[model samples]
Target: MQRTKVKELLAGAEEGKEVLLKGWVRTKRGNKYVTFIAVNDGSTIHNLQVVAEADKFSEEALKDVTTGAAVAITGELVASQGKGQAFEVQATRIEVLGKADPETYPLQKKAHSLEFLREIAHLRFRTNTFGAVFRVRNTLAFAVHKFFNEKGFVYMHTPIVTASDAEGAGEMFRVTTLDPINPPRNEDGSVNYAEDFFGKATNLTVSGQLEGELAAMAFSDIYTFGPTFRAENSNTTRHLAEFWMIEPEMAFYDLQMNADLAEEFIKYIIRYALENNRDDIAFLGQRLEEEDKSKPQQDRQEMSLLEKLEFVVNNDFERVTYTEAIEILVNSNHYKKKKFQYEVSWGVDLQSEHERYLVEKHFKKPVIVTDYPKDIKAFYMRLNDDGKTVAAMDILAPGIGEIVGGSQREERLEILVERMKGVGIHEEDLWWYLDTRRFGGCPHAGFGLGFERMVQFVTGMGNIRDVIPFPRTPQNAEF
Candidate 1:
């Protein structure tokens, strides 16, 4: 007989019916007559209970089978009498598939620090917290596909290696075929990269927006969801060397419409994960309660992820221009108590602290800060009528400072070419981008959302490194 999922077995199956199960022993307790064991098959965090009489299976047989040991069993399904579970199994045959050394296994009955878990990433998925997180991660990815697919968006795969540095921060991980120790030297004493692989020079893509714009021109609506690399050395909770980003490029769309789509997309993902994995969310909530009684009441809110998402999806996003946001921050009563490091001014870029205050304290909801000063935004953003601000918008949530960054592209060929010059970007470097505007261009807009940041925000995870499997950070790249 085929093995049943642990979760399915727990839902009160046929009593006295033969069943086969395979899993790792999570916990075990026994008396003289029989032994009770909890087995989990990696399908879900919840485990199935198995009862075996002393005569049926030797007590010494599994005495050494501690936690994390893999096993299989043939048993009779029966309704559980325990308060913790609704159903269980009565084992007639047992098989030890894999043995885990009790001394070597990192996981124990007690809780382990998140730092400790990071070191053992390969085995972290077996832990309940990580299992729940990755499950939600998988569902969120599917949700992205579902949302874009239904809206007539073409999924495009942009090049992983490119010549353009999208962020213009000069933090690219250089990819070269030549040796660095004694590399080819140009007559000017600089590195000669005429013979480099991919020729000239190349690096891993920081963002797909540039190429994505080319796709949007052809497909009208296109989105690229893939891994993006950054070589920034900052060791913040938010920064990572390698992370996934979602760039949605839309032709004939303005900044406002782009912001609206981003809001809706975020809500849709949270809703999908909640609806599909309600049990896991509930389990986490309960587990958290048992672990930390002093956690904030809002954290314990029984509002299902779907319900919270519904509230966001059905309602209009609170929108405020950058100028208005600065005014609120400058005049808000709460500002009196705290000393802000960076001054909030008309032309200043909003820091994470200010962003947090705006979303968490002022609006108490997701807010879109739009029309930022041109000096602070990217060169591609469309210049607004004010002659100082760009048609850009950033979606800020309560805890996550900026979840999405987007702007309306400069469509006028002359204006775009001029803006490129103003930003000190060479006309030759962005010739193709300029050609797009010269030949066929419509007012386009899009956003780049850090996928790990989104996961961290939705799951209330503190660190970006925790969300991505095998995270690559400065001085911290271990498989």
Candidate 2:
């Protein structure tokens, strides 16, 4: 017999039809005559309620059907006598595929703290909260590819290892095969990278934008979605040693065009979730509401989950220059009250508090702050005619500070070389990249969307680690 997914079975499957279902037990309740079991197949957050007769399936076999127990149930569909759900399955035979000891299972019938769940991440997917989050995550990822494909953008797979630093952040995980305790060295006593596997220094890629730009020159428009690594030692919730990034590069695009594409891309995905993953989103929203109940009124979010998602989809993001944003922040009540931990200055990088203030309080919407000082931005960012600011933009969301960061690339060879040199980036290392300008370069622009951050914003998840399965942070690599 073909097995039916819990989602399809719950969604108006013909009653009185025999069905085979397989799932892990979420919870089980029983009396003298009958036993009730709630099962989830990872198809949706809602579980399929199953009713079984105590005499039919022996108590010994039924005892194996507890929380976290995997089972295969052959049953008949019928209207549920219960309150919350519409349909329930009356099982004729119950087979325990796998048994989880009720005494040792980390997840129980009652609510478990998120921190505790993280410790048992290998089993976290079985929980309702994570199940809903990952389903919405799947839809959002597909929506990203769909949005780009519909816009005639080619999907480019950039290499995961490279010699150049795209963002010049200098935080990278080195890839080598040399002995760590004792390795080959040059006459100068420095480690000889020539003796290494790659024959020179190499590291995991931090961004795909640079390579995506090369593809864009020929393809006209290209996007790369792949894993990027940053070896920062910071253990904050916002930082991840390894994460996914989405970068789209286009020829003949300026700063405004890049921002336009980013805004459209964001809205299209959120709207996709609202349409396709409505059930999961609603479940997550309700979960957030339950979590928010313990917070003070002043600390609560201004909008509900659906309301916040709709607001971004419906409204145009407020666009401002870095200079203008600084002025607004300095004169704002937070800065005036000395509540901001980081100083709000014209050239300083905007901190979480500053960015959140602009989006949540000052603008009360998504804000795209552009034209940052060249000193604070990457060498690849296009230098504006003002000779001070680069054509860069950071999109700040109401909850997450900066979800996307991108800039228009420098096209002129001399200027590109100068910018690279000014930043102490040797031209010999980026000869191929400089060749783009040397041969035939046109005005180009691109932006990077942090995949985890977007997931965090869409799902209303506070910690970045919760949004992604198998999060990689400093000193932690547990499954």
Strongest candidate by lDDT: 2
What TM-score number comes out for model 2?
0.99
What TM-scores do the predictions have?
0.94, 0.99
Q: Where is the poorest 10-residue window by lDDT in model 2? A: 54-63
lDDT for every model? Answer: 0.84, 0.92
Q: Candidate 1 residues 1-479, lDDT tens each? A: 89888877776565678989998888888889988888888787788889988987787887766788898889899878778887889888888899888888888888888789999999888888888878878888999999999999999999898999777778999989899898888999999888777767899999999999998998999999999999998899999999999999999999878988898899888778778877776666565446445667655534444344456666677899999999999997756666677787889999998998897778767889999999998889999998999999999875569989999998998888788888789989888888888888899999998899888766656788888888898899898
Supply candidate 1's per-residue lDDT for 437: 88
Candidate 2 residue runs with Cα over 4 Å from true position: none
RMSD value for candidate 2 = 0.9
The C-alpha RMSD in Å for every predicted model, in order, reads: 2.3, 0.9
Best by TM-score: 2
Q: In candidate 2, which residue pairs get closer than 3 Å at backbone N, Cα or C atoms, i.e. clash?
A: none
